[model samples]
Each structure stands twice: as C-alpha cells, then as structure tokens.
Target: MCKKKPYLLSSIREGARLGIQECRNQFKHERWNCSILPSIYTSSSSLSLSVLSSALASAHSIFGYELTSGTKETAFISAVTAAGLVHSVTRSCSAGNMTECSCDTSLQNGGSPSEGWHWGGCSDELQYGMWFSRKFLDAPYKNSSDSDVLSAMHLHNNEAGRLAVAKLMTVDCRCHGVSGSCAVKTCWKSMSSFEKIGSYLKDKYENSIQISDKLKGKVRRKEKNHRKIPIKKEDLVYTNRSPNYCVEDRKLGISGTHGRECNRTSDGPDGCNLLCCGRGYNTHVVRHVERCECKFVWCCYVRCRRCESMTDVHTCK
Candidate 1:
C-alpha cells in the first residue's frame, strides 16, 4: 500500500484556508446576532465531509476497526438523519444549485467496537450532527452575496435546503482539515434542546403572516405576558431534529402544522415553532397558560388578519 502524509494533498490544503476564512467570517457575523450561538447555528468542517468519502472508498478501511473519515462521516450522517436533521435526510431532496455531492446515511454499526467506530453512541452522533448542521447553516460565508442570505432566509422553511447550504458551506473545510479549519464552534447545540410542543404550536399559528404582522405579534407577545418567563429580546431557539432555527429558543415544536391546543407562541411568521405543544389537532389549551384558539368559540390562540384592523364586527359594513 502506498503511504502518503496527510498534508500532501493540495486540494485539502486549499480547503483548510477557506475553512479559516469561514471561521473568521462567522466570528464577525455573530456580533450582530449576539444571542445566536455560532456552534448551534453552524456545521463543523467541510474538509471532514470530503475526507469521509475518501475513507469510504475502501471496504478494508471499514474492517480495520479504527476511526476512519468515512466511518466518522457515516456515523454522524446517520445520527443526524435519525435524530438531528431528519427532515433533510429523509426527503433526499437536492438544493437548486447542488453539485450532486451525496453522503451515506447509515449508522447501524455506530455503537459497536467490532463493526466500526464511535463518537460515543447514537445520541452523541445525533448531537454531533445536530451541532455540525447548525454550524454550517448559520456560518457566514463569502461564497454567496448577502442577498443570497436574505433569499435563503426564506429557504429556512425547507429542511433539505438548509442541509444543502450547510454541506456546500463546508465543502472547503472538508477538503482541508479540522485544525482551526472553518470552525465557528458556537455553543448552540452544546446545550440540551428544550422540548418541542408539536401540536401545541400548530394551534397558535397565525395565517397570512406579513412583516407587519410579525411586528405586531411580537409586541402582543410582550404585552400579554409581562410577568411570565421573559424571553430575552435577543435569544432564539430551534428544534434539534430537522428544521433548526433561532438556535437560542431551545424548546421547540414542529413547524407549519396544526395540532391540539396548548398556549405556545408560533416560532415563525408561518407559525409552528412552539415553546410547548401536544398530540393532535382539535388542540386544547393547557391549564398553566391562558388557553386560546381551542376548538371552542372564541380563541385568542388563533389570531385573525382582518380582525386586527377591525374594532367591531358589525362596524365592518
């Protein structure tokens, strides 16, 4: 077998440089989104992802019972697929300009000493991939113009799209190495994610959400609960499994789905990200919070678009 030193590869070297650039960029942007942790919002390294493919090229490497790049990549991908970014992994959707790069999504051998390597265990990989995806997703890159960021912000709704962006953003890093390579290391995913109230969130979702509506709703949120748990002005959070957003708002619920009632605020303009949620539709509000938007008559849970402008229903005529 031909033995080569790790630094011999030119492509890897260039990737390392790019990774450094990304790290520097992330350092700069996190200043504005001060509350958003770079680690939780970003992926670790593209160089690692590339190295994974090379390691997978040979089956012998898998049997070596050592930590190979492919095994690391595979295990991490599997964990993320199952527990982290399940949305993107399950759909197998490709981004608009994706260059056909693909990854293996299997991790049955993750926990075994005989089969392959371990990043501790299933939950660990899930957490690792969760953090990995986040770092890339939120990492600031010069690859695309700021306009792309604004445009991609809309893509936040699509789990696969976010994953693709993450993958692409880390391409240079993967080519390089993990030594200070494109690592922003935000503590976003490091902390335990808060619970997701799936059904509870849907019940509170407001429809036809405009920028103005967002402004008004936040104001309403502040006014309605002056004495309650104060969500700091800058803190945000997102789900660990698929569709990550906010990064600081740790407690989460599935996005864009209607479900049984609980008094949780919708996380986005479209609603869905809830601080607390429940089982199914026909949602009933919880006892602790002022339940609104129940199947019952008047629901403050579901807000109305026209009504926000209306003083009286009879006066509309």
Candidate 2:
C-alpha cells in the first residue's frame, strides 16, 4: 500500500469532497455538469437502453484514461481542487484544528498608520495553503519534464486553479469606535466564496487554451498563426479534443442525455431540445410540499405552514 502524505487522511477527504461539490455547484446548470469525474463507465450488458457501435466502444475506451488530459475536464478539476484545498486549510486553521499552520502574518495592511486603518484580524493563511496544495498536488507530476504535454497541461491547469483563489481574495474589515465616533479600522484578507471561484474557473474552462504539440519543453498553440504567442501561465491548456456528451457510450465514458432532467423553456444546452440530443423528452407532473407562511417565534425559531405545489418535470427520452 502507498503511504499517505503529512496531512491527515480526513482532511484530504474533506478537501476533495469540498472541491468536487464546488465543481458540481458551478456546473449544475451546464451540460457536462462536472459528472465526468469518479469515472462514468457503462458496460455493454448494462447499455441495453442504447446500443453502442463497436467503433464507438473502442473510442470510448481510449477516452476513459484520457479524462485527466481533457481540456475542459482538466480545467474544472484543477480549479475545484485548488479552491477546496484553500477552503479546507483556511477553515481548519481558523478552527484551531490544524497543528502545522494558522492565521497569516505576511499579509500587508493597505491603510497607513496616519491614514485610518491597519490589518489586525486573524487573516487566513492563503500562502501556506497554496504552498501545501502545490507540494501535495504537484508531487506526482514534478519529475515530468515540460516536454510531456499531458503533465504540462495538468500542471498548467492546476496552477490556474490556485491562481483563481489568489485572484479572488477579498478584504474584510471591522470598525472600532466609541459610541458613534469612528476611530480606527481593522482589516484582513479573506478568500472569496468557493462558488465565485468555481464560476470564474468555469469561464476559464470555456475559454481554455488548446495546444497541439510541445516544442522544446514548451507548449505551443494549435493554430499556426498563433504559434508565436506563448501560452499564459494563468490560462488552462489541453492537448486532446473533448467528446460530445449527447449520447451514452460506455467506451467513451459518456453518460448520455437520456433520462436527464431538462428545462422545457430553455433554449440553451440545458434545454430539452439540446440536452436530449433532439431525441425528444417526456413531461410529468411533480407535486411538492414545502414550508410556507413562515413567522418568527418569540425567542428565535421560525414557524411555518405546509403548502402544496405542482409543476411539470421534463426528462429526456
């Protein structure tokens, strides 16, 4: 069995789960929905609902191992993993659960002493979290030279993920005063919500860079006219083309749109027309009972009445 890292296994598991949840939350309305992870495999016997051509099966198998290298998938994974790492580390540190690290001391205060403000709160140690993330995540790919397109792509995407966190760091401040007088202010740098980071990374994934081949240990753009343009360290890079997820195919590891919930009024990819791959969908009525007419109680609790509602639910055929 392989030995674990310096970190606790529970922390690692929590971090991974948080990251995956962030990805799902960001992609909840998108076509891919970040379900490509954990490996969506369909066997020939299990795919009786949709017959798979032999050629398609072979193509599917090729893509099974290639998920880690896929451009969009790689971008999502990297961003989510980075976000989760920071979230887990910072929270753990703040809760006094982490023994190795605590609040940040390196973060600088913007307002001068003569001005009005200074950094004073227990700032989240993003640098330590980022350093730990880089060391832990990049360990497997460290020995790989830049010439290896796959490793190069993963590293670049991973860095992009970490950068997303760094780019979205926000400043939170509190006012200190006597009575109504404003005297001084204390501020600390904090991370933006994971949702925001995930959304930002999703945009990056949509606009990710496509590289054809490596030249002299460097990734070059696929377009000949853009070959001279060096890839940015902040941008995500992918070497392989993504497969169409419209249909279910075990070989390609695609979970087709059949039976997937869709919006009837939507014209986007999540709409029934696009999501069902033009195969059509079935509509069914769903009844929901939710708490309604909520009122605050004397102490603090809320009292509510049950209300019934009904709506049409559409599923791809």
Candidate 3:
C-alpha cells in the first residue's frame, strides 16, 4: 500500500488553490485588458495573448493612431457577445460534434447551441495539473444499482485506484463513468434472484449527501466566490491571489486522487485510452462493452448512482 505523503498532499492542495487563483486573475485581467485594447493591442504582449495582434498591428500603420478607450470597450463587448452566441458551434469542433451552431437558421429551427460551446475553441488544450472524473446517477443518491459502472472502471484499473474510487463514489459525488441502459448490477455475469431482491432494498444515495446540520449549509471556504482584490489607483495593477494559500502547513486530499466525484472528465476509464497510471496510482484507459450491444463504441457516457440513471450506449444485439 502506498503511504500518504504529507508534503505531497500539501503540495497538491497548494497547487489547486494556486490554479483557482490564477484562473480568477486571468479572467479579471482579460476583462480589464478589453477596456485598454485601444491603446494596448499594438504592443508586443498582445501578439499571441489575444486578438490577431499581428493583424491589428498591420492595420495600425494604415488606420494610424490608437483607438479611444470607449471604442476599444465597445469592440470588446461586441466580440464577447458574438463569441457567446457562437460558442456552442465552436466548442464542439474538437470533440467532433459541432452541428449545434449559433447561426440564426439553426436557432430559428428550434435548436439550442448552449448545450456545449466555448469561445475561440480555447478550452481544447490540456493544462499541466490534476484531472477528475464526475458521475451523475439516475436517482438523487447511490445504491447497489450503481456499483456495476464503478466496478467496470475498477476492472480495467489497478488495485489502489479501484479501492479509492470505490469509497469515493458515494452520495454527493458526480461521475463520468461507464453506464448503459442495463442496470449497473454485476457486469460480466448476471446475478441470482436473491441478489437482485437485495439490491431493491438498499437506500438511494446522492453525491452531495448531507453530512450534518452544521456542515450541511456550510460552504467550502475555497469554493466560495472570491473577494476581488481592489486595484491600486496609482499603479498599473495586476490581480494577486488571496493570501489564504500562504499558510505554512495546511494539507488536503481528495476522497480519491481525482478529487470531487461530480468533477469528472467526459471519458470514463477510457478517456486517455492509454496504459499510463493515473496520479497516485496505476490505471489504464479503456472502453468496456458487453457482447450484447450493436452500436457499442465511440460514445461518451455519464452515470448518476442516485437516480439510477444509466444512459444507453447502444441496443442489445
């Protein structure tokens, strides 16, 4: 068994805190930068940071002189609104499912693009950091009916990784796992009638189960909306992370290495489709299918143990 390293856990916690901080800073700066683009776009930093800085620079020579702050702000607002309108089409490009575009024709035809859209397709890249898997169960909670998906992910995974997932996949957790129309009961083999009867008797479980009255309504200190640091009036100010992360010996760990259960990747154990070990333990990415299916491969699935909601990957052959 691998012993939990205190420093290692500390480092992980620090990294999460830092990433959250960085994300907030980036958004705030991006918004502030839009307000200053008229005077700043031609500068070297804007080259790849955003906007075809190159195109904007070339137009600068002909257009001559900088844009006023109001002009920059107006253009920035238009871009944001346009991008939001078109985000559904743009974001699905990488995943090979972009028909849900923001085009007027598509919208008028009673189609919604907000199902999945991101601007400039910038979310396609993977950053160097921790990743997680989230699951959504059919019921508002978990029970024996949900074990199969969890077990299947385990079968294709290492001992340590499986054990961690087993405990972590309870009520209050979310997941992106291998769930099909068939009950997630006893995969690879059917169960006896007695076992099935027992399954019906178990309690429904939820990802966000109430721990207790005191902690129930309490929010995670870190997940709360950040108190925006006020910018200094005299300096060219950049946002700084909150000082809470500076503690000397604070430590944290996920229920499993992947952290929150609801916060899972779209791909199940098969997301990577590789033999590489997941963080803290060994795991192999794979697609699990029963011989019973006709259209079995190349589908993304999400499972919720609570409602016992298992999506259909394909019809049984």
Candidate 4:
C-alpha cells in the first residue's frame, strides 16, 4: 500500500516496461503468469509499483512485487525486479543513454586476465546496475524495524535474483582476424537473456526455502525439514504459506483457473486434468486462416494463398 517514487520517472518507466515484458514473456507458459492487473475488488496491489501506473490503472497490474503470503509469487517478483533493473540499466549504460555511466572499462586498466581471457569489449555494466538497483529497489525496506521477517525474506530473495544474473554472466568473445584466423580476440562479460533468468528463478521458486521462525533476529529453517542443508545466500525464502489457487480469491490475489485454456495432451500443470481443478473442461472448435503454398518470386517479393484450418480448443469450466 505504500509506494515510493523512484528517481528518473521516464527512465524508470522504460525499465519497468522491460521488466514487466520480460516477466510476462517468461511466465507465458506457466499457470501463474505475471499479470499486473488488479481485480476491481482486491485489497492487495501485487507489485510495489509504482512500476507502471498507466498500465496498472488500465487493468494490467503485472507481476506482483509486494511481499505476500504466497512465497512463490513474492520470490519471483523480487528476483524479476532485480533482474529487470540489472538488465535495463546495463543495456542503457552500453547504449550510451545515461550520462552518469558508460561502458565498463575495468578490464582495460591492467586488470589481470586468466588463461583464454581476452577482456576488451564492453563489460556487463553489472556493478553500476547492482548499485543503482540496491539504492532504488531497497528504498522500501530501509530504516524499517517492523516486519523484519518479511523484509529479511524479500531482501534475501532480491539479492538472490541479482546473484542469478551474476551466475549467468558469460564471456562473449569474437575473433578479430581476417577470415576468422586464430589471432586477436575481443571478449566481454555478458548477461543471459531475461527469459533465462526467469527460468532460473522459477527453479529457485520450486526449491524455495521456508523460514520456520526468526532466530536471534535472523531467519532459520525448521529442524527435521526435508531440505536439511543450510540455506544458501542465493536461495529464495518465504514466511507465509501459499494458497491452493483453485478458485478465485481476490484478497489472496489468485484469479483461479476457470475459463483458462488448457492443453489436453499435456501432463504438466497446464494439462486440462490439473488446470480445471477437477471441475472438468469445455471444448469447442476454432477456425483460423493462414498463409500457405507460397513461392518466391524472381528477385522481388512472393505471393501466397490463404488457407483455413480448424482445431479444438479446451477451456476450464
């Protein structure tokens, strides 16, 4: 319910768009897709945003960023937001849009390189990104003693997201010799696409840690837990239990799966058997048109004929 305005509204909006789009793209195939829209009667606003107000008001609330009872959603949002911040700022720095930062030149200044290391391209602007993101995104949790448990979990998950990005940093290299001969090379630390980051976070979500109770002002797992190992800094953490998500619950922020399309052949969560929540599904035939029998013209364009196809569509009742 408390929203703080970030610096650089225009740039933040652009960054938010990138983050939201990436989240949606990553969760498209999943059941709990990252949607920004808030129900007309829901009390909780998913995201701490202020990320995209116009779209939010227009009914596209997007990935909920606020810490909720649902640990999975909270973990994902925190990670995605951090990842988004890193992705956007790094891109902006490389693109020369921001005046405050520029291409990473740390390696060019006598930094020791390991074997097979040719660090001479624009290094990933992760340092700047992490700093700026910490300042911007951590504003809400700073100077607050109340909600220590929730705040700690969120902060941990946020850092976990950043760590995910760092873990995925790769050495991007290109040969600089004529005909690609074995000569000089250019390489830089590059980040994986946001989709990959999301997938990684999804795995983290599946294996998220549960905070049984606060121990000496720190989160501790319950003994006798299946995951007996100590939690890693990169692990996602949650305090509250999640809902079943079988029916609509506005306060819980679950829209339910009714009327949602399901794949009949799929055996996963998206399968009709599971998605419908044992309520059964309704099927109907849908017709669509497509371009077919296209042939390339001499050296110009090509023409194609229209073709019609029909397929069965299934939706949860």
Candidate 5:
C-alpha cells in the first residue's frame, strides 16, 4: 500500500500523532500520564534515514514497554490509534487527495419525499477507511498463535476503536428553497470529532475488563466467578493488572507522580491527596502575566494592557 499510494504516508503519520496526543490528553491527570520514550532503529539506506529524520521522527515514541504489558492503557492506545487512522484517511478521501476513494455516493437520490429531505451532499466514505485501517493495523496479528493473549487483546481493542468511529457518525443537513425556508433539506452522514472519539475510548478504559491471560478457546474474565459474562466488541479488555504508578520504576518506564502538579482542592484523580499517593504535596506561589483589557483602535489594530497575578500552585512531594 505504501509503495502504491505514497501520499497516504502523511495521513498515516497524522493519525499516529493524533492518537498519541489524545492518549496523553485523556491520561494527563492519571499517574501513568501516557509518557513516551524515544525508539531506536537502524537502517543502512540513506532514504530510510531521510524518512526517519523528517516524517518518522516520533513514530515509535508511543510504543513504551507498557504497550506490551497487557494493561488497560495499552488497550486505550490501540483503540485510539486505530480510530485515528480511519479519521485521517476518511478526511483525505473527502479532500480528494486519494485516487482510490472519495465521498460516499451510495445514498444519493435516496430519501423519503414525505419527510421533505433528501440525501444529497457528500457523505463521508467510512467503509473504505474502516477496511484500510483493519488491513493495515491487524496484519501483524493475523498469523499469531492462539496462545498470544496480548495479540488477541490488541486486535479486539483495535476493532473497538474503529467501532467507536462508526458509532459516533452523525447526520448533517442543509436547508434550501427561498432564504432557507422549511421546504427542503439535504442531509449527509459525517464523522464525529476525534476528541469525542478519544473521550469515548477514555470512558471505555475506565471500565476496561481484565481477561484471563491463558487463552482457552476464547477470552474470559480473569475472575472465575465472572467468566460467564460475555465480552462485547466495544468494551476494552486487558490481560494484566497495571502498576500502582505511585513510585518511580525505571524498569517499567513508569515516571510516577513525584514533582507532578496537583490540584489543592477537589477530590478527583488530580487532587493532591490522591495524586501524591499519601506522600503529601508542596505549595508554591507562581506569578502569571498575560494580555488583558484590550480595545479596538480606529485603525485595523487593537491595544491591550498587561496584567499580572500571583496564584498558589501545588505539586506532589
């Protein structure tokens, strides 16, 4: 695919970046925080070096050892990235950048006349995007042995991510006929924003289920009593429990919460008491300056006065 459609390389990179950034944003208040580690690779060809220097600089940054640890975080990463790829590829298709695909025309000239609306504009072509994402991301696990629990978990989460994109698709309509009267409407299907997809995946992560590491004919809950419960395609799954993430562990690449900023008030995950893991926190007064009290001038410019304020900031001890 890369050899045939080189233009998609940019979209693929964008998708990866989108996924990693969303992962970090969703976990910002958590102990893990989705921190990345630089990857090392060797290539003898100059072209590979050029590609590495420019487009693929941070390609492997998100593949921390934890990704293979079979934790919930890993599930979230897999799902988000898979969704991101579908999003970017669909966008590229809509923008007319790709030769193999374009906006979906299946619904054209199809709608109920009684409802006074028709499917006319370019509905996003999600099918092609979904197909491509699956082929590209799932190829590695296709031949994996049945005992590869981590591979199975990743494959399931990848589908969950793609499913999220499909589930959140919405219909947009434009009114026509004499200054936008309620006479006619053209509706088209559109994808939800990537932020929404990330939020959905985060919710799934919070409720992620732990599956038995030992693969029997199919995946089951780690707990024997709940093994009868059926796992849904949309649910995120993991095989291993995560580290406490309160103290630094170099071996696992967990930075822990030391010196991390925390909210002095509130009882959420960001609260000092919880984020600090009972080690306590330190308070500091920090000064902030920014533009304020702006006014438009007669010309094409505006003027503003600088404002300064001192606020208390807290960090985990």
Candidate 6:
C-alpha cells in the first residue's frame, strides 16, 4: 500500500503525530502522561519519509510492549491512535489528496424534502478512512488466534477507536435561498475535531472494561456478574490492571511523578497531594518575565512594557 499510494506516507506521519500529541494532552495531568522514553529513537531529526517511517515502527514496538502489559493505558493508546489515523486519512480524502478516495457522495442528493433539507455537499469519506486504518493497524494481529488474549484485546480496542470517530461524526449544513430566507438546506456529514475524539477516548479509558485473561472462544468481562453483558463495539477492553505510577519503573517504562509540577490548589489528579502519591511535594520560587501592557500603535504595530513576577511553583518530591 505504501508503494501504491505514496501520498499516504504524509498522512500516516501526520496521523501518528496527531495521536501521540493528543495522548499526551489527554493524560497531561496523570502520572503516566503518555510519555515515550528518549532511548526509543536515536535521533530527533526532521520528519523525512524514512525518519517518519522509523518513528512509526518504533511506536508500534512500544505499543506492542504495552499490549503485552495489557493495561488500561495501553487500551487508550490503541484506541486513540486508531481514531487519529482514521481522522487524518478521512480529512485527506475529503480534501481530494488521494486518487482512490474523495468526499463521500453516497448521501449526495439524499435527504428528507419534507424537512426542507437535503444532503448535497462533500461529506467526509470516513468509510475509506476506517477501512484503511484497520488494514494498516490491525494487520499485525490478524493472524493471532482468538485465544491469544493480548492480540484480542488490541484488536478490540483498535475497532473501538475507529468506532469513536464514526460515533462523533456530525452534520454541517448551508442555507440556500434568496436573501438567506428559509427555503432549502444543504447538509454534509463531517468528523468532529481530533480534540473531541481524544476527549471521548479519554472518557472511555476511564471506564474501560477489564476482560478475563482466558478467552473461551470470546472475550468477557473479568467480573463474573458482568460476563453476560455483551461487550459493545465502542467499549475499550484490557486484560491486566495498570501498575501504580507513583515511582519510576524502568522495566515498565514509567517515569513516575517525582519532580513533576503539580497544582497546589487543585484537588484533581494534577493536585500536589494526589499526584505526589502522598509522598508530599516541594515548592520553589520562580521568576517569570514577559511582555505586558501592550497597546496598538497607528503604524500597524504594538508596543509593550516588560513585566516580571515571582511565583511559587510546586512539584512532587
């Protein structure tokens, strides 16, 4: 596929970048923070095609290790990256960047006339995106047996991620009439912003299901009472509980919360008490300097005065 559709290389790189960045953003306040070890890649060179390919391969290796761990964090990474790939590829299709796909025309000229609206514009081509993402990302686990717990969990989470993109797809419409009067509306389906997708996956991660490690011809929740509850396509699944990220574990690649900045006032995950894992925290006085009190000038320029302030910063001990 890479040789046949060389243009897709850029989209793949963009998709991986989007996924990793969004993962970090969603977990910024958490202990894990979705960080990749510096040793994973040797060089931080610019994103040439070869470099990008290497990066993607390295990411896959990392994800593979996480999959073996079978933790909730691993579930989130699988889902978010899968959704990101679908989003980027779909956007490319909508933009006519690929010869094989363009905006979805299936809904074109199809709508309820009684509602004074009809589908007429270029709806995002999510079908192609979903197909491609599955083919590329899920291809590795395709040969694994159903009883292989790690592969099953990974495949399920990957589909859940793709479903998230489809679940959040929205409709955008344009008014068509004289003087913008109430007459007809042209609507098209579009995917939500990547941020929204990331947020949704984060929520899913919070409520992710833990399946039994043994696969008896199908995946089931670990709890006996919930075994009958059918796993939905949108639900994230994992086989193992996550390790507490309070202390660094080089073997697991966790950086822990030591020296991590924390919110003194907040009671959330970012709060000093919780984030520090009851180990306590340290406070330091830091100075900040920036341009302040800016005013617009007549010559299309602005002037500002330099400002300096001292503040106390808190970090986990």
Cα-based TM-score, every candidate:
0.18, 0.81, 0.15, 0.83, 0.89, 0.92
Give lDDT tens digits, candidate 3, residues 1-317: 00332212222222222222222232231212111223434445432222331222122221222111112222222122211212212223324443322212211223222532212211221111101111111121123454332222111111121122222221111122356332222111111221121121111100111111122222111233432332111111111121211112212110111211111233432222110123322233435434332343446654333222334231101
Give the per-residue lDDT digits (tens) of candidate 1, residues 18-121. 32232223222211111111232226533343432232122122222111111121222212211223222211212211123223224333333343233221
Candidate closest to the true structure, highest TM-score: 6
Our model 3 lands, by Cα RMSD against the true structure, at 29.6
Strongest candidate by lDDT: 6
RMSD of 6: 2.3
Candidate 5, lDDT over the whole model: 0.83
Candidate 2 lDDT over 1-317, as tens digits, reads: 01444444445555665666676687666556666323323653232212112111121222343345455775567656756776776767766777777888775655566767898887777776777667767666676554477766766777888888888889898888898555888888788888888888878888888887554567778888988888877787787777667777766556777889999999987889888888999999999999999999999899999999999999999
lDDT leaderboard ranking: 6, 5, 4, 2, 1, 3
Once fitted onto the true fold, the runs of candidate 2 whose alpha carbons sit more than 4 angstroms away are 1-7, 36-66, 107-110, 144-147, 289-307
Q: How do the residues 1-317 of candidate 6 rate in per-residue lDDT, one tens digit apiece?
A: 67877788888888877787799899899888887645445455433445445344345554435646889988998888888889989999999898889998889869988999999888998889999889888877776555488888988999999999999999999998999886999999999999999999999999999999887877899999988889999999998889888998777767889999999999999999999999999999999999999999999999999999999999999
Model 5 pairs whose backbones collide: none
How big is the positional error of residue 179 in model 1, measured in Å on the Cα after superposition?
53
Which has the better lDDT: candidate 4, or candidate 6?
6
lDDT of 2 at 222: 85
Each model's lDDT: 0.25, 0.69, 0.22, 0.70, 0.83, 0.85
**Which ranges of candidate 3 are over 4 A from the true structure?**
1-90, 93-97, 100-243, 253-317
lDDT of 4 at 69: 51
